[model samples]
Target: MSGLREPYGRGADEAGFTLVEMIVALAVFSLLSVLLFHNVKFGVQAWRSGSARADELQRSVVTQELLRRLLGNAYPLIIKQEALQPRIDFEGGSEAVEFLSEAPVVSGGAGRYRFKLFVDRTRQQTDLVMTAAPELASAQDNSASRTLLVSDIDHAELAYFGAPSPGAPGRWNDSWEKQSDVPSLVRLRVSFHASDPRTWPDLVVALRVRADVSCVYDPITARCRGR
Candidate 1:
C-alpha cells in the first residue's frame, strides 16, 4: 500500500501545466513586449523632434548674424552711376534691397560687391535670394551668383526708416533712394507657407552710420562739397 501511494504522489507531482496556464503565460509575455515597444517608439520620436528643433535654431542664428553684418557695416561708397548723377550705395524697397558692401574676407570676393536681396517667387513658393556682383562692374545678370537666404516663404516685406528733415516725424517707408545716403534702419519680415514648424522673427537692424540728408558742405568752410 505505501508503494502505491508513493507512485501516485510522484505521478501527480510530474504533471505538466494546464492549457489555461500556458495561455496566461503567453498573454503576459505579449503585454510586456507591447509595453517595451511603446516606450522605445516614444523615445525615438522625442529624439527626432529634438534634433529637428536644434537644426532650425542653428540656422536661424546664422541667418541673423549674416544680416547683422550686412546692415551694421553698410557703407556709403559713392560712385558716378550715370552721366553726372552720383548714386547712393544703399537702395531699399518693400520687397528688395540693394547695397554696396565689402565682401566677406573668407569668400573670394575681397573688395566690394553689389549685394541685392530680393524675393524670387515660383509656382511652388517664394524664396529670398541674395545676389552679388562686383561693385559697379556691370555684370549682365546675377542669375549664376545667388545665395538663398530663406526658402518656402509665403510672404516677405522690407521697410526703411529715415527722417526727411531733422526733428521731423520719422516714419517707415516702402522705398528709399536718397542717392547720397543710407537708411537709418532696415526692417525685414518673412512668413512661410509650408508646414515647417520653425518661424523667423522680424529683423530690425540699425546702421552704425546714421542717415545724413543735409547739404554736403564742408564742416569748417561751409562751402561747396566736392564729390
Candidate 2:
C-alpha cells in the first residue's frame, strides 16, 4: 500500500490558482485595462483638437485671400447723376465702405459692380457682409445682392488716406469727403470678440487706377469734366 501511490489526482503544482491569487491577477488585469483605455482616449482627443485648429486656420487664410483680391481690384469709375453733380463712385466711412470694383466676389457676372462692405450686428451674432449692386442702377432699381463674408465680428472700421483737395497734404481720414476723386489708400480693420479664436490682420490696399488720370478737372463744378 505504501509503495502504491494515491489515485491520479491534482499535485501541488497542479492545484491551479487560489482565491487570493485569482483576485490579485484580476486586479492587475483591471489596472492595465484602465491605463490602456485612458491612453487611447487621450490620443483621440488630441487628434480631434489638432484637426479643428487646422480647419480654422484654413478658413482664415481663404477669407483673407478673398478680401485681398476684392480690394486690390477696386476701380475708379465715375457715375453721372440726373441733374446732380457727377461723383467718382467711391465712398468710404468709418463703419462702411462702398466703391466700384472690377472683381466680383461671385463668379460669372462680369461687368463693373458697386461693392459695399459693412458690419451687421444682432443679438445672437455679428457679421461682416458685402452688398453688390449694378454700376448703372437707376434710382428705382432695387436689385442688389448681399453676401456674408465673416462672422462673429466685434467691429469693422474703414479709413481713407488722401488729401481733401488736390495738391494738399495727404492724411488719414475717417471718411472720404471729396466726391470727385478717389482716395489713394483704403484701410480695413476688423476685430472679433474676446472669446472668438479667429484674428484678422489689418488690410491696407492702394488704389490702382487714379480717378483723374485721363479726365479734366473742373474747379468751377468741383468735378472731373472728361471721362
Candidate 3:
C-alpha cells in the first residue's frame, strides 16, 4: 500500500496542465503576438513615409538644377517673320528661340546647348529638350544636333517682367516670341505632378536669363555717346 500510494503521488505531480493554467498561457501569448504585430506595422509605415519624403526632396533638387542651367544660358536669336505680320513660335511643335552657350563645367565639354519646352500630348506632360550641337566634321546632313536635357513636366510658362518699351503695357506675356531681344529678366513658372503626392514640391521657379553684348543700351547712353 505504501509503494502504491508513493507512485500515485508521483503521477499526480506529473499530471497534465489545468484548464486555468492553459488559458492563462494562451492569453499571454496572444497579447504578445498582438504587440509584436503592431510594432512591425508601425515600423513599415514609418519606413514608407520616410522613403517618400526622400524621393521628393531628390526630385526637387534635380528640377531646380536643370532649370537654373537652362535659364542662365538663354540668349537671343532672330526669328523669321513676314513683312507686316509679326509672329513668333514660343513652344509646342513650333520653332523655338535658340540660345547658344558653352556647356556647364559639370557637362565637361564645350558643346552647344539648346533648350526648348514642348507639350507631349500623349504623355500629358511638358518636355524640355536639350541637345548638343554636332561637330562640324562628323555632323550629318540629316542628323539633328540637339539633345534632350530634362523632360516629364506638367506645364511650363514664361513671363516677361521689366521696363516695357514705350507703347506696351506691363502684363504676363503668354508667349515671348515677338520680342526681338531677350528681356532683362524672365520669370519661369513650371508645374508638375508627382507619382507620390506627398513628395511633390511647390512647382514655381523664376530665372533671370543671361544678357549678351548685343543687347540694346539705354537711350541716354546712346545720346551721350553721340555727344
Candidate 4:
C-alpha cells in the first residue's frame, strides 16, 4: 500500500493551482480587463460626441425658422416725424438690417414690432443678435430688448432686393438706399467659424406685407398718402 503513493492523500490532478499557473491566469485576466475598459471608454466618448452634434443641429433649425417667420412678416410702417415727410421705417445694410414686422420675439403675441438684426463682435467670439421694440418706439428707445440668435458666428451679411424707381426692374443691392420703401426680398447669409461643425442654409425671406393697404402711394412725391 505504501508503494501505491498514499491512497488516502490528494493526487496531482486534485491539487491546488501552482505559482506559475496562477501567474499566467492573472496576466490573462489583466489583459482582458484593460481591453474591456478601453472599449467602454470609447463607446461613452462616441455617445457624447453624437449628442452634442444633434443638439447643435436642432438649434440651427430653430433659429432659421424664427428668422423666416420674422422676415416674412415685414410691415411697411410709415413713420411721420413732427412736420416732416413720412418715411418707411426700414434700414438695410450689408452688415445690419432694421425693419418692422408683425411677429414679436419676446411676447409671442399679436402686435407689430421693430427689429434690428446685426452682428455683435467681442474679443472672444461674434454673435448674431436682434433688438426688438414696439413699432411706435423710436430706434433710440431704451425699451428695446436684445436676443442672441446665433453664437460664435464668423459673419452676417444682409442684402436687399428692390427697384430703384417706379416701374423699374428690381435688382439686388448690398444696401437699401430708399428710406421710403421696403425691400421686396431680404437675404440673410450667416457663416460660422471654420472649426464649428454646425451649418445653416441661406435664408431668403419675401415680404408678404410690403405696402400699407390703407394708404395710397403718391407717384410725384414718392410717398404714401391718404389719397
Worst lDDT window (10 residues) for model 3?
Answer: 86-95
- lDDT score for residue 201 of model 4: 87
Clash count of each predicted structure: 0, 0, 4, 0
Instruction: For each candidate in the order shown, give its overall lDDT on alpha carbons.
Output: 0.76, 0.78, 0.50, 0.82
What TM-score would every model get versus the actual structure?
0.79, 0.77, 0.59, 0.82
Tens digit of lDDT per residue, candidate 4, span 43-112?
A: 9999999999999889888888888898888778666555566677788899888887775644777667
lDDT measured at residue 78 in model 4 versus the true structure, 0 to 100:
68
lDDT of 1 at 62: 91
Report how far off residue 114 is in candidate 3 (Å).
1.0
Q: lDDT tens digits, residues 147-166, model 2?
A: 88888888888888888776
lDDT of 4: 0.82
User: If the candidates were sorted by their lDDT against the true structure, best first, what order would they fall in?
Assistant: 4, 2, 1, 3
Better-scoring candidate (lDDT), 2 or 4: 4
For residues 103-220, could you state the per-residue lDDT of candidate 1 as single tens digits?
Answer: 8655675766777889999997789898777654655664336888887878889998886554767788899875456778899988876687878898999888544343364545
Residue 35, model 3, lDDT: 100
lDDT of 2 at 146: 85
Give per-residue CA lDDT, model 3, range 1-227, as digits (tens). Answer: 65555656677766978889999999999999999999999999999998977876786677667656665565443333335332221221232334444455555656544444443344455565544443232435544445443356565555555334546766544445455445544555545556624333433334344334343334544321211
Q: lDDT, candidate 2, residue 51? A: 91
Using TM-score, rank the candidates from best to worst: 4, 1, 2, 3
Off by over 4 Å in 3: 1-17, 77-98, 104-107, 123-156, 163-169, 190-211, 214-227
